[model samples]
Target: VDTFFGDTISMVVIMTCCVVGIIVNVFILVIGYLDWATRKKLPNCYMIVSCLSSSRLLLQGTVLYSTLCQGTHHWNVLRVQSALLVLSSTACLWFAACLSAFYCVKIATFTQRHFLLMKLRISGMVPYLLLGSMLVSLISSVPFIWTDFSVHLCNSTRSSVKNTTGDSTVGNISYFKVFILYLTWMTIPLLFFTASSTLLIASLWRHTKQMRRNMTGFKDLSTQVHSNAIKTLISFLVLYFCSFVAEILLGIPSCLAKSRWKHSICSFIVAVCPSIHSILLIFFNVRLKQTFKGILLSMRGRILSPFVLSFVLIIN
Candidate 1:
C-alpha cells in the first residue's frame, strides 16, 4: 500500500508538471507567432527557440500519456509512446543545438575566414537546418516501429524470460542494437550543443577580459550581453546534462530493475527540463519577458476588480 501510494503521488506530480510545461510551451508558441504576424519575420534565434518549445510540448504530452498509462500491459501502445518520445526529444535536442550554434556565430568574435563565412551565411541556412533536423528525427524514430516492447519491458523488469524461450536472447540483442542507435543519434546533437556553447563562452570571456583591461571596468552593453549569454548557456548546459544523464539511466535495463523510485525521479527530471529551460529563455528575452509581465498584471487586475467592486457596494 505504501509503495502504491508513493507511485500514485509521483504520477500526480508528474502529470501536474507536464500540464504546466505544456502551458509554458504554448505561451512561447503564441508569443512567437504574434511577433511573426506583426513583424512578418521571426528572428532566427527566436525561431529555433519556438521550434524547441513545440517539440518539448509534444514531449510533455507523451510523458503525460505514458504516466497515465504506467500500468498498461498493451505493448503496442507503449511502443508508439516510446517512438513519439524519441522523435520529440531528438527534435528538441537538435533545435537546441542549432540555437547554440546560432548564438555562437552571431555573438562570438572570431577573425578566421571560415568562421566569418559561416556567420555571414548562417541566417539564410537556419530554415534548412531546422527542416533537416525534423527529417532526421523522423528517420531516427522509424526504427521504433519494429521494436518489441513486450520483450523490452520484460528485460527491463528482469523477469526470467530466457527459461521459457530461446527467443528472449535474440530479442535482447536486437533491443540493445536499437538502443545503441538511438543513443548515437542523441549524442551527435549533444556534441554540437556542447561545442558551440563552449566556443561562445570562451570567446565572450576573452572579449570581456580585453574590454575590462581597456575600459574603466564599467559594464557596457557588450559586457552585459556577454554576461547574460554566458549565464544562459551555463544554465542550459546544466539542465541539458541532467536530462541527458536521466535519459541514459532510464534507458538502462539494470537501472530500471534496481529502483523504481529512481525511475520516477528521472521521469520528473526529463519532464521538467524543457519547461525550466523555456522559463529561462523567456526571462532572457526582452520582448517575451515584457509581454509575460503585462499578461500577469492584466490577470491580477481582472482578479481584483470584482472584489473591489463588492467592497465598494458593501460600504455604500
Candidate 2:
C-alpha cells in the first residue's frame, strides 16, 4: 500500500467547509432561539425554525470536531468520533423528517380547527413532538460506539479498509445496510407528508375557489392564499428532494472506480445541506429576515460591549 502524504488538498477543502458549516449553523441556532422567544404563538414558522436549528446544532458540533482534528496526524479516536458523527448525521435526517411531518400535521389539522386552534398552546406542541421524536431516534445510534474502524479518519472521510481493489467487501455491505435504514426513515415519513400535504393543498384550493365565487369584493385574497400554499408546499418539496439526492448518493457502489469522487461529492452534500435548508427558509419565509436581523444585532452587541465598556472605564 502506497502511503500518500498525510496532508492533502482535499483535507484543506473539507476543513474549510467544516468551518463554514459551523458558522452558518451556529447563526441559525442563535437566530432561531431568539425568534422563538418573540413568538407569543407557535406558528408553523416557529416549528420549522426550531426543528431546523435542532438538526443544525448537531451538524455544527460534528463539523467543529472535524475541523479541530484537521491537518493533525491521524488520531486513534476514529471509532468514537465516527460513532458521534453518525449519530449527529442521523439526528439531522430524523429531524428533517420530523419537520416535514410537523408541518403536514400542523397544516392539515389547522384546516379543521383554524378558528379555535390559531392560539398558542396547541401550536407549540407540534415542534416539541418533532424534536422529541428526533432525539429518541438519534439515541438509538449509541451502539455504534463499540464498532471499530481500522483507520482513524471520520466516517464520511473514511473510504474503508481495502484489500484487493482498494475497497472492502464487508464495509460496502455495512454501508449498504445503513443506507437502507436512511432510505426507510426518509421514505415512510415523507410518504405521509406528501400525501397529507397534497390533501391540504387540494382542500385549500377548493375552499379558496368557493370563497372566490362567493366574494363580490377584493377577490385576490383567495388566489393569494392558494399561491402561498403552493409556495409553502414547494419549499417543503425542495427540502425533501435535496434529502432524497443525499440518500441516493449514500447508497452508491463503493467498489466503483469513481468511489472517491462519489465520497467527495456526498461529503459536500452532507456538509452543505443545512446551509441550503437555511437559504430555502429565508427565501420562503419573510419573517426569517427579521429573525436574522435580531440575531445579528444581538451578536454585535455581545461582541462590542466589552470593548466599549473597557474604553469608557479608562476614560472615566
Which candidate has the highest lDDT of all? 1
User: How far out, in Å, is residue 115 in model 2?
Assistant: 14
Tens-place lDDT digits, model 1, residues 1-316: 9998999999998898899899989999999999899999999988998899999999999999999887664545656887898899899889989988998999999899999999999999999999999999999888776665444554444662233332332222255677888999999999999999999999998997888688974668877887777788888889998988888777766424577877899999988888788888877777887787666555545757776555434423
Clash pairs, candidate 1, are none
Per-model C-alpha RMSD = 5.8, 8.8
Residue by residue across 201-258, what tens digits does model 2's lDDT show? 7666676777767887875754664565467666666666675576456445444334
Worst 10 residues of 1 by lDDT: 164-173
Q: Candidate 1 has what TM-score?
A: 0.89
Total clashes for model 1? 0
* Model 1: CA > 4 A from native: 155-157, 160-173, 254-256, 302-316
Cα shift from native, residue 279, model 2 (Å): 2.0
Q: Which stretches of candidate 2 lie over 4 Å from their true place?
A: 1-21, 35-48, 60-76, 106-128, 148-179, 204-232, 251-253, 256-258, 291-316
RMSD after Cα superposition, model 1: 5.8
